[model samples]
Target: MAANILLTRIDNRLVHGQVGVTWTKSLGANLILVANDDAAGDELQQKLMSTTADSSGAGIRFFTLEKTIKIISRAADRQHIFIVVKTPADARTLVEGGVPIKEINVGNMHFAQGKTEVTKKVYADAKDKDDLLALANSGVKIYIQDYPGDKQYPITDDLLSKVE
Candidate 1:
């Protein structure tokens, strides 16, 4: 069976309960790929995410952005894959690196210094806005929805214009 990309999402908190259970179940994904540079090399993070994925009864894989870009094609053809990235930049990188992503969901991004609040659950700084703009320009649809049953808010140029 050729695995297809079920969904791609950007969430700082990668493999938590909502994602492991709700998202996986709703999407009918058998595999979850958490692609983030920091988490991939961190043994502690890997184990934690793996445990979460296990609890959800989904096969999980962890890889840095580069490694994911390199292996995404092969992985996608193997099982239904749900990809989770840590940031907008990471999603842009994946698309640029040939991941064939057409849409992305913004789940959660914590508030940080210098970031303007884009939504109750998302914050964006300059680089993040830039990355998101690039992704939009490249024909990738971006939306914010923390869960499968939530209403989706599409990311628009008008929205970005008001972020400052």
Candidate 2:
């Protein structure tokens, strides 16, 4: 059986205050899954994120792309999972690998070289745009909303064009 995935968010800062506290509380999620390849392989990061999750009264797990694809389907129905990935590409990989993601919340893709600003909180580069477009083509509802209380802006072709 598939896990009850409450939310799939793209935030470079995964499992931080906003995610571990606000999102979990709002969604009533019992588990926060940081499905990022980098975080999954780092022990110190895992420890720190675990501390944050504990403080929020939610369990947390870090998993690589492959591991997430393999294990997420096994999560019990009672596990209300809030998944966070670092980039749109990572989100696409999860969906392609059969993670059952139907929608994606585009959160923080902080400014970096080669990336264009899509929103004050979101920036995207060539590869990011391609991945996002691919996800949209595959029938995923992509939108931008930093916090739980913020307004959601749907990712339309016009918005993607602005990033170009």
The 10 consecutive residues of candidate 1 with the worst lDDT sum are 71-80
**What ranges in model 2 sit over 4 Å off?**
none
Query: C-alpha displacement of 35 in model 1, angstroms?
Result: 0.8
**Residue by residue across 50-160, what tens digits does model 2's lDDT show?**
888998899998999999999888999889999999999899999999998887999899999989998999999889999988888899888899888889988877888
Clash statistics: count for each candidate: 0, 0
Model 1 stretches with alpha carbons more than 4 Å out: 1-3, 76-78
lDDT of each structure? Answer: 0.87, 0.90
